[model samples]
Structure formats: C-alpha cells, structure tokens
Target: MFKKAFMSLALLLISALSWGQGNPVHFTVAQKQVSPSEVDVVFTGTINNGWHVYSTALPDGGPISASLNVEKAVGAKAEGPLRHSGKEINIDDPIFGMRVRYFEHHVQFVQRFKITGKTYSINGYLEYGTCNDEMCMPPQSVDFNYKGNGPKDAPAATDETAAATADDASPADSAAATPAGEAQDSVAAAAQAQPADTATASIGDQLWTPVIDKMKAYQPDTEGKSLWYIFLMGLLGGIIALFTPCVWPIIPMTVSFFLHRSGEKGKGVRDAIIYGISIIIIYMTLALVITALFGPQTLNEMSTNAPFNIFFFLLLVVFALSFFGMFELALPSSWGNKVDSKASATTGLLSIFLMAFTLSLVSFSCTAPVVGLLLVQAATSNNWVAPAIGMFGFALALALPFTLFAMFPSWMKKAPKSGSWMNTVKVVLGFVELAFSLKFFSVADLAYGWGLLDRETFLALWIAIFTLMGLYLLGILHFRSDGDNPKAQPVACIMLGLCSLAFAVYMVPGLWGAPCKAVSAFAPPMYTQDFNLNKTEEVKAKYTSYEEGMAAAKAQHKPVMLDFTGFGCVNCRKMEAAVWTDPEVQKRLNDDYVLISLYVDDKTPLAKPIEVKDSKGNTRKLRTVGDKWSWLEQTKFGYLAQPYYVTLDNNGMPLSGSFVYKEDIPGFLEFLDNGLKEYKKR
Candidate 1:
C-alpha cells in the first residue's frame, strides 16, 4: 500500500508540473484608494516561466506589446499608460540589426484613476501574447476588476510601503505627509504617463483618425468615384511609364499609329480623342475593382497589420528583382495574343480600339510594377477612390501623348528614341522599387515591436543600395545584356557620379549617430542605436513617466513639445536621426524644453479613458491613446500628415505659430526657443 501511494504521488507531481508549463496567462488587478478624487490600480501578470512579455517601448517591427482596455465606467477617468517595473532582457534582432529591450520576469503595470462620481469600480482586461524563445503563444485577454468607494468621504490616501519606509520618520509625520506625497506622486506619474499629454503622440491617434474623418466627411460615401487619390495614382503611373521599354519605344510608334488611324488631315484629332478615352476607361475599371475589394477600413487595418506589411515587402522585393532582370514577369500570352489577333481581323474604329487594348495587355510586364505600387499606396491612403482616380489619370496621360502626337505626326521627330537611356530608366526604377520595399518591412517591424529595421540599419542599407546604383550608372557594374559602353556619356556620367558621392557623404554621418533628416520617416527610431548622442541622455536621465513630465511641466510653467511620431514614420525617424542630431538642435532640445515622444504606431493601449471630439464635433471616448492624439492632431493641425511638432502652453494652447514637419530642424528649434522666450516675457 505504501509503495503504491508513493508512485501515485510522484505521478501527480509530474502532471502538475506539465500543467504549470502549459498554463495560460493570468492577470490580477489591485486597487488602492488614494483620495476621493484618485485611486492607484496595479496590473500584474503571471506567465509560465518560459513565456515572455513585451515592453511598452517595443521597437518597430517587433511584437504586439501588452495593452490594457478599461470598459466604460461613469464618473471616472482612467489616466495613463501601464507603467511596467520588472526584470529586463535585451536581445539582438536580425531584421533591424539592433538590440531590443523587453521584460521576462513577472511584470507589474500601474495606472491611476480619478473619480468624478460618488462611487465606482475599475474593470478591464489585460491583453498580451506569451512567447517562448522559439515561438509565440497566441495573444490572450484576461479580465480583472477592482472595486472602489465613492467620492463621498474622500477615501483615505495610502502611501506605498517603499516610500513610507524610505521616509524614516516618526509614525505621526509619516502618516500625514506620506499619504499626501504618495497621492501627489501617483497623480504626477499618471499625468506624465498619459499618452495624450506626451510630446510625441502615436500615429493612429494623431494623423490617421483626423485624416480618415476628413476624408469621410468630404466624401461621405465613396462608392464609385476615384476622387483625389486617382489623380495621385495617375501622376505616379505616368511617371513610371516614362521608364518602361514598351512605353518608351511606343511613344513615337503610337504617334505615327494615331496619324495613320486618323483618315483626314484634321480627322487625326478624333482618333487621338477616342484612344485617350479608352485608356482612361481601362485603368479606371481596374481601380474600381480594387476599391470595391478593399474599402477604407481594410486599408486602415492593412497599414498597421504586421503580417500583411511583411508580405507586401516581400512582394515588392520580388517585383523589384524581376525588374532588375533576375527573371521576366509576363502575363499569359493567350489574352494579349487573342487581342492582337482581333486587332488584325477587325477594321476601322473597332480595330483601332482593339489594338489599343492589345497594346496595354502586351505591356503588362512593364506596367505591373506601377500598378502594384499604386494599389498598395491606394490601399493605405485611407481614401477609397484614390486608386481608381490615380489609374484614370495615368491612363489619360499615357493616351494623351499618343493622341496629340498622332494629330501632329511631324512632331514625332522631337521624341527621344528608346535607347540606352530607356534601359537606364528601368534600372533606376528597379532601385526605387527596391528602396520602397524597405518601407513596408519597416512598418511590419515597428508594428510587431521587432527591432529589425531601426534607423542606422535602414540608412546603412540605403547607403549600400544607392552606392551600388551609382556604381552601375557610372558603368562600374554590369548586368546581363548590358552593352559594352566603355566610354561613359559626360552629362549622365557626371550626374551619376556626383549623386553617388553626395549619397555616400550623406550616409557617413549616420554611421556615427548623425540624424539623416531627409529620410527620417523611413528609418527607425534614433534611440535604437547603441552610440546615438540623442539616446545617451535619454538613457541616463531619470526616465520620468508621462504623468510626472506633465506635472513638472505644469509646475514649471513650461510649454509641451508635442511630437506626433511613429516607429514606422520614415520622416519621423529621419528627423530624429538626422535633424535632431544637429549640435544646435540637440542643445536647444536638451536644455530649453520638455520633450515627449508619442509613437502613433505604438500598439500599447492606454489604461484610462481617452475622451476627444470626433469630426462630427460630438464628444466620444477613445479606447486607445493613439485615437485621442490622432483626433487632437487632426483637429488642431490643418494637415493630417505626420512628424507633426506642436508647442503647447501649460493649458495646452498652441504657442502662437508653433508647428513643424520634417526637414525643419532649424525652424523647429527656433520655434521652440521663441515660444520659450515669449512664455518668459508673458
């Protein structure tokens, strides 16, 4: 009997251990009533030993950091992001080629709440993913609750044991002063940690909401029309066509074709007119189909969706490689061949239209990249009609040249031949496509909190790419079928060499932690660098929470530097890595101001209620910090674009004429200095 009991006990222990290893994430919420007006709520998470949780400061392209969502409650305002205190682990990520800081041990996230009613209860769920070293566990949401007394008696203020112990004073003094100090500290910390009050607001909160609302209000319902986006798409399409072999050679051929198609001398005008209309219809139909498939909501979702962005990056890279002559991308010949056969059999007007359609089909290899680029741009634009409109414009531009030249075939003599220059244009566009692919990768990296595409790494990649491109342009490199042009053309050669030299010069400072402001939005945060001057003080400085920063700003009567930046904002990264690194700029930022960076792309949700007026002017509670800041940015700034810098006084009034975008480092510093001076004068 004893032996059997021992074996059973051992088996039970083994089962228990296995169960613990597979345990789902568990969350607990502890509440301490500070006063009638405030309460401190602490969120603690317990994950299985092998599992890890991401920090709020997860770099771009990493993982979905933990977020807190508080259900709506009456008369209570939750104020701030979850503040984590625990063990930290650093790991080098391959994508960005940098170290990413994260939390491994059990983590505690603290948030404060201010009560406006007589009584209330805090209710919310902690949302996060558990990842072991090799793979990630699916994200889980665990519900938690904390009951609280109403404002009637003004709940007794309680000081943290640490703070109380540190006082080392008599019980009487500690009781009276410690409670007040703790309350004050809690409030101050809450204010500072609140994402809405921070200098840098998240992109979703700052730019997307307002722009989306504006687009919605203006269009109300974008069912069919291509709208403003179509124009942009068309412009890009036309520019892209200027480089393709099919389009370049056909420019002159089409003009002659139109002239021949037009029977009478003056009748050439009619043929040109019909051809242009056909092109518009074809591209517009394509755009319409895309809009119908992916509406505004999907577009918005895709912008921040990590997996989708990664796929897009890979797709573009493949397209770019194909363009660079790794392989040919061709449409099924059946479609174009059928159109070509019809073109030969049909007569007059029908034949002309069929021939135009056939030409478009045959040139799919050349136009596919442009189409893909436009579709991606339109999908992310938040403008439903942008794709359709852009395609229409592109098609119109392409057709217009053919029509106009046909009307006056004699002018064909002025058209440039499809020669070595055409191939050069293709190569240039291939490089462009390659560069843009990185942007998508950066987005995915930032969204996933992966540090694979940080600022320096991005710049290094660009430097290498541009260097290679310049070398190729200068005839130092050759590809398959590359003609033996031992002698380089003076103008082309000089321009290529000079551009290469300039690009190399531009990238040199980036290696030593210089801000390459020109391309900030495309790069990662400057803070990711191991040797960045901007990050040095940031690391050593007593990193105050957003709530603490706000309280200090309020007490000091200092203006707030509202920086609406993002992990994936190329311009924002560029501004920080390049412009912010300037000596004069660095000195001013460090000395004269309180800097707050609000990453619009940050996935971490706030622990409190984010109330803001929507485009309709109705007050709405924002569930995330990104939403609140996005509303603020749109309502306050006329523009919806980012790298938005706003200087606001203690009361949050925009310091008169204080706003900036990328590449305005000098202007931005001057603006901040001037605001400081004016505040002092006042």
Candidate 2:
C-alpha cells in the first residue's frame, strides 16, 4: 500500500566534486553527407581519462546506457537503428552481478537518415552516464541542435584514412587498451586534490581504523521504526478494503449464517470465534507461502532486484485493471464450490472452518488486489518477518468484524446500508492503484536508464487519472456499476471529489517544473525534469570524500557536516525535499560548513583493492567505491548508518553529537547551531 525507506548498515559513499568535473564525456553531433539525399548522423563521445561510458546495447540493471533521443527532425527520417563503435571491453561488475560492455576514451554512434529537404534541423537530447574509479556521476543530459550546412571535409581521402577506418572497425584488445599508468594517474589526482596533512597511506597500508560498535545493538532502533510503519500501511489497506461492495455486503450475511447454524448461544459464539481464527490463518498462510519456498533471504534480495521491480509493476497493473472491473480475478469457481460442498457435508467445527475458507475464496475478487498490494509492499521492506506481520495486521482488521457482529446479533441492524457509493470506492481505488503502479515502473525505468517515464511524464499521467476520477466521483462521468444520473452527491462524496480536483490542480505546476515536494519520493528527481522554474544551486560545494572535505574545511576555518546517504536511500531523499529545502536550513548548510555526502551503494571500483583488519578482528577487503566510503564511515565515526549527520572540525574531531533521520527544520537548525557553538569553543 505504501513504500518504506530502507537503509543498510553497509554504506558506500560518493564524492560531491564529481558533479562539477565538466561531464566525464564531451559530445559532438555531426552530419556526414553520404549523398545528395542520404546522410549519416554520427554522435561522438570523447570520454575523459579513467572514465567509462556504457554502451546503448547493455542490458537492464547495469549503469545508464548512452543513447540519442530525437525530439525534432524536420524533413528527415532515420534510415536504421543506431550503431556504435569504440574501444570496447567487458567488465564483470559486482554491483549488477553481470559482465557488461563499456567504452573508454572514445566512442562513436551513427544513425543514417534520409534528408528530403535542404534545411533540416535535428534537435534532441543525449542521455548517458559516466563512472571512473572514484565515483559515478548520476546520468546527465546534453541538448544538441544540428543543422547541415556543407559537406564534411574528406579525411585526407587516402590509404592512411582507410587504415584508420579499418582499425576502428574492430575493438582494441583489453590488455593494450588499459595501462597501469592510466589508473595511477586518477589516484594521484585524487591525492593531489586532498589537503596536505592526511596520508593517502591509511587506505593503502591497512592503517584505516575499523568500527567496533555492535551492529546488532544499533539495529533495533532503526528496524523497529521501519517494521511498525509497514504494519500500519497493511492495517490501513485492510480498513479501506472494508468499504468495498463485495467485502461489505458479505460481512453481515456470513456472520448471520454462523449465528443461525449454531443452535445454542455458547456454540454460536465458539463457531464465530473459530471462523474468525480460520480467516486469519488462511491469509497468513498465503503470505508465508513465498517465504516457505524461497526462504527469507531470497525475499530480501528480490526487494532491490531489477527484474522483480519490473515484475511488480506489471502485476500491479493487472490488479489495477481487475479492480476497475475489466474482468474478475477470483480463484477458480470449482475450488470455492469444493470448499462449500465440504462445509455442507462436514459437521460442527470442520464445517465452520470450511465456511471461512469459502468466504475467502468468494470475496477474493475484491480482497485479492488489496491483499496483493499490501503483501507486495511488505516484500519490498526486505525484512524477513515483515510479510507475516503485514498479513497478520490486515487479517486481524478484516476478521474482527465477522466475530464481533456474530457475537451481538442486534448490532447487525446498525450496519450502514450497502449503496451505490460502495461502487464509488472500488472505482476510486482503481485510479489510485494505477497511479501507484507507475511508481514501480519509474524505479525500473531509472535503474535501466530507460528514458520512457520521466518525472514530468509521470506527473502528467497522474494528473489525468485524478481528473477523470474526480469527474467520476462528481457523477459527471460514470462507470458500468455507477448508477446513471446520481441525483444527490453526499457531502462526503462531494468533499472527496473536490479534494481529487484540487490534487489535479496541484500537479499542474509540476508539469512546468514544480518540486512537488509532497510526492518527491515517488517522483523522479528535479534533474530529470526537462523544463523548470526553480534554479539549480549556484554554489556547488559538497564533497564525497571525508579527507578532502575535511582538509578544505580546515583551510577555510569552517565545520564539515558529514551526510551519510546513498543512491537508493528513500529517507535521504525525503529529508532533502522536506527539510533540507527549507530556506533557513539551506542557508545554514550552505554558509556554515563544508557538506560532504557519502553514498553507501555506489559501485565504482577502487583503483586497487585494499585488505584491512578491523577492531572486531574481521578482515574486510575494500574493493569497490562503496566499500571504501562505507569502510571510512565505520572506521572514523564508529557508526554505519545514514541519514546519519554529524559535524566535524579540521583535525577530524566531532564538533557535536550525531543525529539520524531528524527532519524537523527547527530541530535540525538547533543541531547546526550547537555544532557551530562547539566549533567556536574549540
């Protein structure tokens, strides 16, 4: 029903300096006149040293692929699919657990086109991502507008040119392409960028300190909060499902059957109690079924897996369609009939159990989508016990009414009459389900670097869905189940419909590039939007490395706020949108300190792997970019969690006590003020 933000103790941090390094790859778009009517559009990428740009042909789950998005092509049509040529090599990336192809130094992609007119302008954006040894810059865009003027000058039209073309036809051997010197140069550059006092040797000589804080002791605080949040989501979904026509109407009928069948007062109470218990057992069993087969570890992994995300997207879409009354998605009728037949033939307690099973089977069309949404969200929590807990919470809410109403026969008359409004609930949920499904789709799109569902596009779809749903609520639009020409809209319905309309209006500004902070976690980042009113930050000052940031802070006589964060961290994004964007908070952060953000999931490989032993006596091998930063966080601060924030002075002493997940603007301001006050005393 809702997504939970997850942060792992294993943190790998990123550098803020990478953002301003002038695009790891410089691009040029040129037109090669093949003939009077045919031309080749060649896109050339000159990659900076030590950086690798991914190929467009790479599969999903890898880094962002390089590609051209054609926005406008007047009087010109593309002849064939895009093709690439480069000094390509295959690297087995630990992050994706796959061998993917990438290019180094230089690459070119060509797309032939037929130009029908003399003055054709090809305008569009280029989407690509770049990563070096130290860190990867998130995918960035380049806008290109190319107009053909004259024929490209021939490249000396001779044998040497022919030889050059022949060489580029085949990929260079891997061993010859990457030299030891090239990797060392990048490392030395990082060293040079750091302040003079620090020894780069700590990373090399295994002198880096290891964190001895007990990981288990620290987990309950974060884990408990996360699990409680997920449980509440499940409870909320169950309560909402109760208002639907299919589930609501059957509640009284099922309770009445149990009360009538048992003959004595005590027996009726026992039968109803047993039936309610049976319902919980049935739903809990379903939630555990996946855990039983694959084990909890697999469920944890699937939460972040790319294919699983895409699968959830499609599955939710089907569920949304079913809820919209496109088709029923109940269990097989024969199966329900068999359970009912068994209940009829069986006596006493067994019959009561069978009746509960029958209820579940019959009501599945209405309950399954809601159940599926809750279970899917629980699975995404990546906690072993979350599914059982979520299902238990949902089933408890669902089963309570059945027992309570059976116990008190007179209360049945007080139940609200099932009306046309019940149908209204189902239709509204369909729109919501459809909107939530796009969020999963967006996660997959961003992970695979597919440009299909950008933030604006996501906002546009949501706007349309909410608008139509509002009209349906107002009786201006009708579904098959909604009665034609509804005479009087209830006050509740009118308010809900107006709220939906207001929500649609709220999203209109987002199309012109509003932050839409209320939904930032679900929407893509501001960088993904093509047009925007809010300006990008003018002062680019955050750093990813601890040493470099600290050194710079020391030189400038300021404090350093270490932001423990990640690419996949949901809460980090929330804090960035909700609190960090506040004027006072932003001003304080920008003016008071050198902000350094550490991303725990960055997978860029280290120049060379380091072997070190921590205080816990565990030998940790630091290999990837994430490993180095994660290792640093634990070693320096004796902590391994993020949105963990703390202020540090030049010589690496803590300026104030640590903070975690604090989003209140004034509270954060106080924390900053305290850190500054402590710094002055020092």
Candidate 3:
C-alpha cells in the first residue's frame, strides 16, 4: 500500500517553465482567391528554433494540437474540414511517457470557404501547443482577422488560369486532410474559440512595478550561511572522532611527546600549536585535491547521480559494519610507519608537519569514515570551497585538545581514560552510521524511480536502527567488543540511550503519515505514505498561474505570496514541512494571503515562449513554466535559488522583502507580519 502511494505521489510531483515574451509560433493569415465564389484561408506559422507545434492529427491525451476555428464568417459557407501541412515527426517523449506527433520550425493550416457575397469577413483564432526539450508551454492561441472583396461580376477562370491557380495554391490546400474522425473534432474546437474575457484583460492591463531594488535589501546571506553550516557539520564530526578509540588514546600520547621534547612549557605549547596548524593544513590540502578532481559542477551532479549515491551508500554501510567490529578498516600500516620515521628524522616545522601526517595515517581506521561522510555532504553543497572549509573545521576540532593539553599539561590528567567506553562510543556511532547510510540509498532510490525505500520503509528502518542503538547503549544488546559487565553502563550513556529510544518512538507515528517535522529533512516526503493523518491539501496554493492568482488576490483584497520553489528542492520541502506547518504561518498563508507557488523545476511549458535577457545579458528563450519563474526570480529579485518567498500587493509592488529557506517560525512570522503591515499602510 505504501509503495503504491509513493509511486502515485512521485508521479504527481515529478510530472509537475519558460520564459519570455516571444511567441514560439508567429501566425500570418492570407486569402487566396480561388474563384468568383470561392477562397482559401491560409494560416501559416513560423515556429522558433527548438520549439515544436503539435499537429492537428495528434492522439487524444497528448499535447494541444493545431486547429483552425472560424468564430465568425460573413456570407461564407464552410466547404470542407481544415487541412494541415508540415513535416510532422512522431517521437516517444521520455518525460511525458507518451508517443506524440508534432511539427517543428514551420506549419500551415488552410480552410476553404464558398463565398456567397461580394464582401465577406472571417475572424477566428489558431490554437496549438508548443514545447521544447526543457519545458512545455501552455495551450496558446493566435487571433486572425481577415476581410476581402470579390471582383464585381468577375468572369469565370479559364482552364489555364484555373490550372495555374491550383498549382499556386498553398501547400495546406494539397496537404493531407484531417481524418474523418478528427475533422469533426477540429470543427468543434473551432466553435469553442472565444474572445478573451474582458475582466482578465483588465487585470493584464494593470501595470506591475519592478521590486528588484526593494527585494535586494532582504537578500539573505545564502552562501555565507551555507558554508558556515558545512563547517559546523565538519566540526561536529571531528568532535565525535575525539571520542573514538584510535584518536582518543593518541591525543594524550601526542601531547606528552611534544611536552617532553621541549623542557620549556612555552616551547611545548608553541610546538603543539604548530602541530595543530599542520594537521589543519594537511586536511585542507586533501580537501583541495578533492575539489580539484571533481569541481563544483561535477560535485553537484554527483550529489543526485544514482550510481554515485549508491556507491556512497554501500561504502557507508561497510564503514558502519566495521564500526560494529565485523572488521577493521584502516590505512596501510607501512604508510603510518614511514610517516612516523620521517617525523623522527626531520626537525623544525617539517618534522611537526610529518608528525601531523603520521597521526592522520595512524588514526585512519576511525577518522576515514567520518571524513568520508563529511566529504560526501560537502559534495552536495555545490560549492567549490565547501570541502576545504569543512575540513578546516574538522581538523580544528581534532587539533584543539592537543594544543590546549600542551599549554596546560595538568588538564590532561583530568581527561577521560581510554577504555571499553571508547568501544561503546564506536558501537553507538555504528548505529548512527547505519541509520545515515539509508539516507544516501534513499537519494539514489528516488532519483532512479525505485519505490523500494518509500517513506514508510525509510522510517521503519530508522526506528529499528535507533531502537537497537538505544538497547546497545542501555547494555541490553552486546557485541564482541563490549565490556564484560553488561549492566555497568554510565549515566551519560543511559541518558543518551533513553533519548535515542524516545526519538525512535517519536518516529513511530510517522509511519501513519503524521508530519514528523523534526526528521522531515532526512525522510521521504509525506506524500509517500499510504495513510497520512495530516492533510496538506488545505495549505496548497489555490491558484498556480501568476496572472490568475494576482487577479484573485486583487478581488479578495489580499496580499500575494510568490512562493518560488521546486519539486526536487529538498530545502523547499523542509520549509513546507517544518515552518509552514506552524499554525500562525498556515493561518496567514491560508487566510490573509494568496499563494502563487512557482515551481522552478516544473517542465510544463508556457502558453507562448518569450525571448528575454538574463542577468548576464545573454539572449534566453523561455520555453517552460520553470524557466519563466526561474527567470522572474533571477531578473526581479537577483536570486536563482529555491524556496524564495516574497509578499506583494495586488499591483505587484513589494509589500516587504524576500525570504529564503529558513525554518525559524518566529522569523518567518515576522516577515509575513511585516508584509501585512506594509500592505495595510498603502
């Protein structure tokens, strides 16, 4: 049941832009005088590069097909069904998962009519759908008006002239006529071509002032905060490493070696500081090497790449099993020995650097997995410097104790002794690693369209892993490396075990589709659950189109919320699950504001493609709905990231500033409150 729900939700989310103000198909209407009482109405369209106009003979449930509608005809009787001419290509669309027929670059439609009066007029619209590889535009229509006067008492054409006329007729006249079944459908579609609603036209006429400058004031510190987060994660990993058996024992040994090597306390402290700095430099150098090898763009791709994510998932699982004492994973013993000997033979800064390298090699068994996890996370950040910054923080945390112990040697005696406790810590981390390994697998599973690790499955695994961890911590579970006395658990370990048990219990309700906001960032989306108690339909935007939504907002006298988001954006989901789930935020979003969620990754095309310039002044074509909104976010607010929120008045002027991905409810409440206040002021 959960698997079916996950597939349905994934399909809906995955199925759900284009810029610009350029019409993908430019239409021209011309009248070809065929005889004294007959004429051909030719509609020729020049489609833009990369854009395709669907054929009139398209299968049902496919894209909008080309059709000619005669809404009004004066003294003219329709003779036959409209005929179409174009190089129609039939191809299977991988994205839409359907076979479709469409025309590229050019197409033409012609309808012949029998004229019964000297003066006649015809007015109609040509409707079709256009799309490119990136995005699809909404159904588009082009209005065409034509008037013609037949010669007064004109003579009938001679056979030569008639033959010439037939030869010179538009290709659409000789093109394959619409099949009998589709011909009636085309006529019915033509009958439905109505003029634009006056009310919608008035809304379109309302001029919207650009709010880029106003929004610039509220551009949050995106990059700085992201790097800071990566650094903190690295630092936390390093601190965890300090409790491991391999690194914890060596800390006292390394500090004592530095202190004894120099009798003067100042010299020992200085040497230790240098050694810490050396460690930082060595790790940073490794980070740089990783950055150089993969590069930022490659790292970003690897983050979502199925194969890459799967490989990391397996690697992390192996690391977890090693932590559980199945086997030891370590660097070559010879490498550590060589580095230690080099440090002994060298002197000054080089000797200290070699000593740091030796320590790094020796502690690889415990440190490598942590560093690998850090690197994997940093890779997903899509920033070239993230790995280096994370490494700097990790190394700093790893080295801080060494420097401090050398400066105050007496403090070293107070440190916890290396014992079975260290092994216990390692085993607890193994549980953590096991839990986190699923996260990587989930990413791959999602990308590959594998429903194996749906929300319920993921939560079940996490609950089981953490429950086992809690049992191990409470001495209820035992491993080969565990201390002989199972009941001799420390108070701190017991507390941690209880917390883990509590957390596991907390996730139990999530299996039933409860909004477990705490773990939303790590778990699959709520839609993946077969039975969800929390209904988010009420919070979803009532209107998706910008113009339609803004028009409604104006009528309702409410502020507009331009929610710049994406289907695949993890942070956007986090914001929705965490912050938007708050009562106040939900109230304001539902009652006070008109939400227009613009998905930057939506593949649905625009009604008509437009040509515009990006920030870099390059000519860009808006082909899809995502492209259109993404362009708007970049051009109007100078932002290209997801989960961007901005409040605006009906006329589209900024009411407040823009907001990015932040989970702080109070801060977001302030943002919305300010927008309401500003709206009321004006």
The superposed Cα distance between candidate 3 and the true structure at residue 145, in angstroms, equals 24
Q: Give the TM-score of each candidate.
A: 0.59, 0.64, 0.67
lDDT of each residue in 503-564, candidate 1, tens digit only: 86798688767767676566665655656644433201122233345455776666667676
Q: Residue 564 of model 1: what lDDT?
A: 65
lDDT (CA) per prediction: 0.59, 0.65, 0.71
lDDT of 2: 0.65
How do all the candidates rank in terms of TM-score, highest first?
3, 2, 1
All predictions: root-mean-square deviation over Cα? 15.5, 15.0, 11.6
| lDDT comparing candidate 3 with the true structure | 0.71
lDDT of 2 at 372: 69
Off by over 4 Å in 2: 1-220, 485-487, 542-558, 563-588, 596-612, 615-631, 637-682
In the predicted model 2, the residue pairs found to clash are 12-599, 12-600, 13-599, 14-599, 15-544, 16-544
Residue-wise lDDT of candidate 3 within 14-98, one digit each (tens)?
Answer: 1001234455678888888898788988889898655677776455334555665455666555566567898977766422335
The clash numbers for all candidates, in the given order, read: 53, 6, 18
Which ten residues in a row are the worst by lDDT in model 1?
A: 12-21
lDDT of 2 by residue, 555-607 (tens): 78998888876553434554675467656667878998888776554545678
Weakest 10 consecutive residues of candidate 2 by summed lDDT: 6-15
Q: Please give me the total number of clashing residue pairs in predicted model 2.
A: 6
